[model samples]
Target chain A: MGDRAKSLRNTIVLIAGLLVFWQLMYAVIGEVAMRSPWQTMRYTVTLVETDFFWVHLTNTLQAFAVALVLSVVLGLLIGFALGLHRLSAEAMEPMLVALYSIPKITLYPIILLAFGLGMSAKIAFGAIHGIIPVALFTLNAVRSTKPILVKTGRVLKLSPPAMVRSILFPAAVPEIFTGLRVGFSLTLIGTVLGEMFAAQHGLGYLLMNAIGLYNVDVIMSVTFLLVVFAAGVNGILLAVDRRLHFRV
Target chain B: MRRVRLYQVGVIAGLLLLLEALCLAGVIDKITMPPPHRIAVDLVKLLLAGKLYPEIGKSLANVLLAFGLAYSTGIVTGTVLHGYRTARETLDPLFATYYAIPVFAFYPLFIVIFGLGDGPQVLIGFLLGVVAVIVTMLNGLDRVPRVLRKTASICRMGPFETAVHVTLPFCAPYLLTAAKLALAYAFIGVIGSEFIMARSGMGYEIGYAYTNFDNATMYPLIVLILLLSIVMNGVLTHWEKLLLARRGQR
Candidate 1:
C-alpha cells in the first residue's frame, strides 16, 4: 500500500511537472505558435465533440484495430515457428533486430506502392512497424521457458503443439504482454504516419491540413489528443506489465 | 556460427531471387517494384551520377549532429540524474511512456515555431534518441560494482578521475548499445521528418521521385537508405559483440 501510494504520488507529480513545462513553453513561444495548456484543453474538449473529428477518429481507430490484430497474430506465428527451431532462431534473430532498427518510414514508399493509398496501406504500414518487436520479444520469451517444464512435457509424450500450448505460452505470457504493449504503440505511430502522407482522412491528415492553414489551435489540440491517448493507454499497460513482471 | 551465416545468406538470396523471378514473370508489375537487380543497378548509377550527393550529405550530417547531441547530452544528464533519486523517480513514468508517444505529432508545431528548417528535423532526432541513451546509461550505472567505487575512494580519485578511469570503462558496452540506438533513432527521426515536410534531403528526394513516378530514382534511393542503415547497424552490432566478448574473457 505504501509503495502504491508512492507510485501514485510520483505519477501525479510527473503530470503536474509536464503541465507546468507546457505552460512555460507556451509562454516562451507565445500565442502565435502554440496554445496554452488551458486553451489546448478547452479546444480539445470542443474538438472531441465535433462530428468531423469523429470521422477521422473512427477511421484511425478502425485502421489501428485491424493492423494490431494482424500484427499480433502474424508476429506470434513467426515468433513461435522460429523459437521452436534452434537453427532458424539462430539465423534469423539478428536479421529481425536489424529490420527493427531500420527507419521504416523509408519503406513507406514501397508499402504505398504495394497496398495503394487508403486504409489497407495504412494497416499494412502499421503492421509492419508493429510485428518485429512482438516477434523478437516472443521469440526470446519462448526460448527461455524453463527447461524442467519442457522436460516434463517430453516425459508426458505430449505433441509439439500441445507442449507449446500447455507449457511455453503460459511461461512466456509476461514477456509477450510487454511485446504487445510495445507493438500497440508502434502500430499507432505507424498508422498515424501513414495517414500523414497522401491520405484523405484521419487525425494525421487533419494535422497536415491544419498545418497548411497554420491553425495553431487544431495542431495543439490534435497533438494533445494523440499524446494523451498514447500516454494513457501506455500507462495502463505499464501498470499491468509491472504486475506481471512482479508475479514472475 | 558459420552454418548459421550460410543459412542467413541462403535465406536472403532466395528471397531476392524469388522477387527477381516474380518481376521477370510479370507476376508483380514493374510499377510496383522494378526487380532487385534493377534497383542495384540504379543504385550504382545514381551514386556514379552524384546528382543527389548534396541531399545525401545534408541528411547524413543532420543524423550525425542529432546523434552527437543526443549521446553527449544524454550521458551527462544520465550521470547527473543518477545522483538525484527523487528526480529520477519522478521522471520514471515519462521515460516509461516516452517512445509510445509519437514524437512526430509535434512536427507540425515545430514547423510553426522553427519554420520547417533543419532545426525541427534535428530536434526531432535528438528527442527520439536522447531518452534511449539516458535510459541505457542509467541501466549501466545501476550495475557498477560498489567495490570499484570503494577502490576509487581508497585511491583518493576525484569524481572526474573515478568516472574516466572506472565507471565509464565499466559501462563501455552499454555506451556502445546506447550509441547504436541513438544513431538508429537519429536516422529515423531525421529521415522521417524530411519525408513528411522537408524541402530537401534524401527522404525528400525519395518523396519527389515517388510523386514524379521516377522509379529509377525512388527505388535506388530507398535501397540506398536500407543498405546504409543495415550496414551501420551490422557494424555496431559486431563492435558491441567484440566488447562483450572481451569483457566476458576478463
Candidate 2:
C-alpha cells in the first residue's frame, strides 16, 4: 500500500479498536452513566438540534474571538516594544516566564469581581490567558532575530522604522503566529473556564447545569462539540502555518 | 544585562507602589482591589496564624502525585508511540489538537468517574501534564541519531540497554524541558480544578473568599499562589541554566 493509504488504514484500525473497547466496557459495566460510543454519537447529533446549544456555543466563540484579536494586537505591540532592546528583554524574561507558570485559572474569581459576571469578565479572563504567551514569544522572536538579517537591512540602507516594518516583521511572523496559536488555545480554555467557573451564560453554564442534574448524555454531547470546535479552529490555523512559514 | 536587570526591578517596584497608592487613595475601588500593603498584612497574619502552610502542603502533595503519574505515563506512551510509526501517525492528529480542548470541559465526567474528591483533581492534572510531556518526549526521541541505533545493534545491545545508554542520554535535554513544562501544567491543572470543585487547596480558599466577597483574604491567597509559582519557575530556570552550562563545558 502507498504511504497515504497505509496511514488511512492505520487510523481506521485505531478508531475501530477504540470503538470496540468502548462498547465492550459499556456491555460489561451495564451502567447508564457509562455511555457507549454509539450513544454519545447519537447524543451529539441531537444536541445540535436544540436552540440552547447554539446560543451557548456562539457566546463562547464570541468571547474567544474578541479575546484572541485583542490579545494579538496588544501582545504584538508590547512584544515589539519590549523586544527592541536586548537589555530590557533579558531583564523581563524571567518575570514573564514566572508569570506564565502561574495558573490564571485560579484568578477567575478576581476577574469576575473586577469585570462583573458578564461577557466583559469572560473576555478579560481569556485575553489575560492569551496575551502573556503572545507577548513573551513575540518578544523572544523579535529580540532574537538573527544579526545577519539586521545586517541585510543595514546594507539596504533601511531606517529603523522601515527595517522593523520590512525585515524584522517578516522574520518574526512565524514565531508570533506560533504564540497566537498557543494564545488561541489558552484563550478558548480561559473563556470556557470563565463560563464554567461561574457564569450566567455560555456552554460552561450549560455544562454546570448538566453536571448538577447528573445528565450524563448532555455532558458528553457538550464535550464532543467542544472537541469538534477546537479541532476545526486548530486545523485551519495549522494549514495557515504550513503555507505561511516557508514564504515569509 | 546587569544594568537592565536593576532597571527592571526598579520599574516593577515603582509600578507596585503606584498601584498601592491608587488603591489607598480610592482612585481604584478598595474593596475590589485590595492594596498591596493590606494584602501583605493579611499574608503575614495568615502565616502567623498557621492556616496557610497546611493548604500549601495539601496543594503541593496533589501537584506532586499528579506530576508523578503524568511523567510516568507520558514517558511510557511517548516511547511506545515513537517506536511504532503507524500508531504514531494514527494518533498524532488528536495529540496535536489536544491542548485546544478545554480540559475542565471534562470535569463533570471526571467527577462522575472519580466521585468528587482528590481522585478527580489528580486525574485532571495528569491529563493536562501528560500531553505536554508526551509531545516533548516525542520531539526528543525524533532527534535520536540513526547512527546510535546502528551502533547499539552492532554492539548486540538489548532494547533495554540501548534505551538506557543511548536513548536516555540523547533525550535528557528535551526530557528536562518537557519535565519543566509538565510540572507547570500539573500545577496549573490541580490548582485550576480546585477552583472548579474542591474541598480544600489554595484555589479553593480563593474561590471561597471571592464568593463571600472577602477581598482581603482573596487577594492574599492570590498573591501567595503567584509567589509559589514564581519560586518554582525560578528553581526550574536555575536548573536548566546549570545543565546547559555543564553541557557547554564539554
The lDDT leader among the candidates is 1
The regions of model 2 sitting more than 4 angstroms off are A1-31, A246-248, B146-158
Per-residue CA lDDT of model 1 for B114-199, tens digit only, reads 99899999999999999999999999999999999999999999999999999999999999999999999999999999999999
Please give the lDDT score at residue A144 for candidate 1.
Answer: 86
Instruction: Show pairs that collide, candidate 2.
Output: none
- Please state the error at residue A34 of candidate 1 in Å: 0.3
Off by over 4 Å in 1: none
lDDT of 1 by residue, A79-111 (tens): 999988889998999999999999999999889
Candidate 1 is graded, for docking, as: high
Per-prediction DockQ? 0.88, 0.64
Which candidate should be chosen as best, given DockQ against the real structure?
1
lDDT of 2 at B37: 85
lDDT of each: 0.94, 0.84
